[model samples]
Target: MEMIKIENITKTYKMGLIDVHALNDVSFTIKKNEFVSIMGPSGSGKSTLMNIIGCLDTPTSGKYFLDDISVEAMGDNDLAKIRNKKIGFVFQTFNLLPRTDALKNVELPLIYSGVSSKERHRKAKELLTNVGLGDRINHNPSELSGGQRQRVAIARALVNDPAIILADEPTGNLDSKAGEEIMEIFSELHKKGATIILVTHERYVAEFADRIIHLFDGKIVSDENVPKNNREK
Candidate 1:
């Protein structure tokens, strides 16, 4: 049931003559349908770890198995294809196209996957409806509230029926009420059996996850499961 296996992963960056080690021998496993949070202060390699998990970047060394596939051995083209087919990303910035409508935004992935226009429309409409934005299908990102914009992003993320949802500080730009609403959507997704991995610095936001993995100096400092009763509070 392990969907992700990361072993002795390390990432390094070169800034001029100086080399920065973003991650160092980090290892972990994430089970399917698990809602987990990655937390750390600035420059702790949490983001670097996330990039590795999401297949946006490769590690400088070590092995990563995503759904049993060896990520480290895959070429850039293969990695891009896997990323398009398997991972769904939700960014804090609600990275929607300003000129596109909700339906269009959600359909972008399907278009890339070569889905027919008729089928694409059907799928996109269904996703928007599921995300509670059916009526706003034609609304552009500018017209929607912050929470609604995030909802559209979520819909877009789910458009391809990805195996995992990777949300990076998804509610950081929203107000408390809006943030709570976004959390509720995530809760619903988890209830319906979606695997979620979120990256955040806020303890309150991290509390929404079933387990939390704290990163410090490119290593896992703590990985703990939340008690059942404290999930929502």
Candidate 2:
């Protein structure tokens, strides 16, 4: 089943009178439960593609079918709802609320979805436990280590049971050991049938994915499956 379909997508940015093409006629399809990475150098359009895939930005002219729902024509309100319900984002900085505890942070999404307080607390606790952070559920972001903070972010992302996990430079700020631990969590998530699309410039981080999509000059340069060893590594 194709969870994502991007056809001839293009994105152009206007800087005063100059026009910059961030993506040009890029097209691809991602199946359900697939782990994929988008990699490239600076200004190579990997970020732009990620934004489009996450529904943070729409293409200039193209068709995007996310789980058979047309996203190209969605308004801001509709897109926001889809973002909350269908996509989970993990960022390099963790993006946790500085003053909130881990459990509260994870429950934030449920609040947006209009879930009851009791159910939200239950779900948040379950997710935090699943991510191996149940003991730290009451700790704020500042009280946790880099790895623990990222785990909280991951738990928050999964709180809504989104269709896809969109991670952008998720390990960028962590040390090697911390990064590996986060990747292990991602591996477990994939095993449990999460569709993951990771965007990164590090080969080591990208290697965690089952397939890699290389982007350059606002276009897809290569899309290939990773070897078994690579996937396991």
Per-residue accuracy of model 1 over 105-222 as CA lDDT, tens digit each: 9999888888999999999999999989989999999999999999999999999988889999999999999998998999999999999999999989899999999999988999
Instruction: Evaluate all candidate structures by whole-model CA lDDT and list the values in order.
Output: 0.93, 0.93
Model 2, position 12, has a per-residue lDDT of: 97
For each candidate in turn, the TM-score is 0.98, 0.98
> Model 1 compared with the native: what TM-score?
0.98
lDDT of model 1 at residue 189? 96
Per-model C-alpha RMSD: 0.9, 0.8
How well does candidate 2 score on lDDT at residue 166? 96
